[model samples]
Target: MEFIFLAAGLIMGLGAIGAAIGVGLLGSKLLESTARQPELGPMLQTKFFIVAGLIDAIPIIGVGIAMYLIFVVAA
Candidate 1:
């Protein structure tokens, strides 16, 4: 049971770190491209948000799962 809790915490923490790194790398590339093409700023910004949301999705789901494990399963 304690191991389950630890594993759940690790899942959420690692998920968040992975998402952050993914979004950071994506945004960096998008910014570099936008800098190269100023006219594409609007389009790139929109795409950035969509990509960011997608990157965040897994981590957010991990958080939900962690909560369930901590509050429900461990209860």
Candidate 2:
């Protein structure tokens, strides 16, 4: 039980950090792409947002699960 919470915490924290870094790098390139193609700014921005949603999905789930384990299971 203790190890489960510890592992979940580590996974959630590291996954969130990795997701943040991935999103930052991807967003930077998305910005560069938009700058290079002004007319496609809206389209590219939408796509970037979609990608951001995808990138966040797992990390958010991990966080929620970790919280559940910590509060409910640990309690």
For every model shown, what is its TM-score relative to the native structure?
0.90, 0.79
Residue ranges of candidate 1 with Cα displaced over 4 Å: none
Cα lDDT of all candidates, in order? Answer: 0.93, 0.89
> What TM-score would candidate 1 get against the native?
0.90
lDDT over C-alpha atoms for residue 55 of model 1: 92
Error of 2 at 12 (Å): 0.9
Pairs clashing within candidate 1: none
lDDT of 2 by residue, 1-75 (tens): 879788887979899998999999999998899889999999988999899999999798888888888888878
Model 1, 1-75: lDDT tens digits are 898899898989999999989999998999899989999999999999998999999999999999998999899
Residue 40 displacement (Å), model 2:
1.1
For candidate 2, the lDDT comes to 0.89
Highest lDDT: give the candidate number. Answer: 1
